[model samples]
Target: TSIPSLPGISTMESLREAMPYFELILDSGCSQRARQFLCTLLEPECQPLGSSVTPPCRNTCKVVAEECSDFIINILDLSQIFKCDNYPDSEDECINLARGDQCFSKETSCGDGSCIPKRWKCNGVLDCKNGIDEVNCTTCNKYQYACESKDSCIPLEWRCDGNADCEDGSDEINCHQEEEMVMHSHASPCPAGELRCVDGRCITLQQICDGNKDCSDGADEANCRIQYKS
Candidate 1:
């Protein structure tokens, strides 16, 4: 069962006043009171701004279901592509779109004889049944492709060779390359006095110079002079 919404009287003037105070405090490095107030606001089981029935909120300040969704969608479109009014809503129109002159191209020879419109280009999955939607994604090979397999795929590479191929190189996944572990020229398998290599990579020496001896050949203090004062 849905919980009943609480209501309250919140004039635009009250929201305006509250907004300014909160914004000013946020702008200033927070004080203890401010932090406590923010903590309460961020608490999971907090109540709405008013009791009984909540006051209406604006787009950015909205608590309304549809307005809130549209507001968030608007904000999201600033950085990411969102399907908009320009998209064809009719299924027939979308299906026939490929046959129209608007989808023509002589330069690209796609698998299904046609390609996705240049405007729609990231290839996560195919939009067309023939998989012609991913025309530009067929180049990966040599560097260990995931699927640069058959002659039918454009760039003639990613066609199913039991392996994938692409050179930003993401097709053949998790083929980890082994890096050769280099031993320092001064390294004696057993070291003394925290004496390890420091060519800038921060590899700490395995041995320590506590006194007497540690690294087989007193390599820790071999050439040092000791002075004692009473």
Candidate 2:
């Protein structure tokens, strides 16, 4: 059945804004069937804006409801798809579905109502089903590189520093290749107080044999010949 065009429920944004009122109605002794219908209408469906089925209208509630009905019908028809009942039996059930998962202190809700860690919001990958998690993300800090995961931003200086700072390992992928090029090029000596390793990389002389392998080939700690002259 088609829903009537309701006042002040035109655009998707307006529908989202009206959700609280819908919830209030449900709580204020609305009929169980009415509440179930409203909850079904509220379920998220991928709707394209400006489609022929969703022409620009001052009140698109009827169209939206029709689309929602079709969406639920299609889901029910899918044999392999498993979802909660087509219509929530209670307001609490509807709310629980709307609040897909518990968010941590440093997390945010996606457009589809799922929660993701805040760090996964804008590193690069689209964690939100609607790609909303990456929208309006804060710009990376100066000299910071964005990871392919779209959830992390690492300092530019940290890239190729013999460490994997980006979760996708993008920061260190070509490090060895660059080092190989430097090795083949002119024999530029390391600056004062810095020692050159076998791989032509440079480290501070102080880093030698202090319980760490600074050199890639372990040359810094190859042999122990400490002499005690008392």
Maximum-TM-score candidate:
2
lDDT of 2: 0.46
Q: Give lDDT per model, in order.
A: 0.29, 0.46
Candidate 1 residue spans exceeding 4 A from truth: 1-81, 84-90, 93-98, 102-114, 118-124, 133-230
What TM-score, over all chains together, does every model reach? 0.20, 0.25
C-alpha positional error of residue 191 in candidate 1 after TM-score superposition, expressed in Å: 27
Off by over 4 Å in 2: 1-129, 167-170, 181-230
Clashes by residue pair, model 2: 122-150, 123-150, 123-151, 124-149, 124-150, 125-149
Per-residue C-alpha lDDT of model 2 across residues 102-170, encoded as one tens digit per residue: 543434678665554444566466756688976877566545765544566787667668888976675
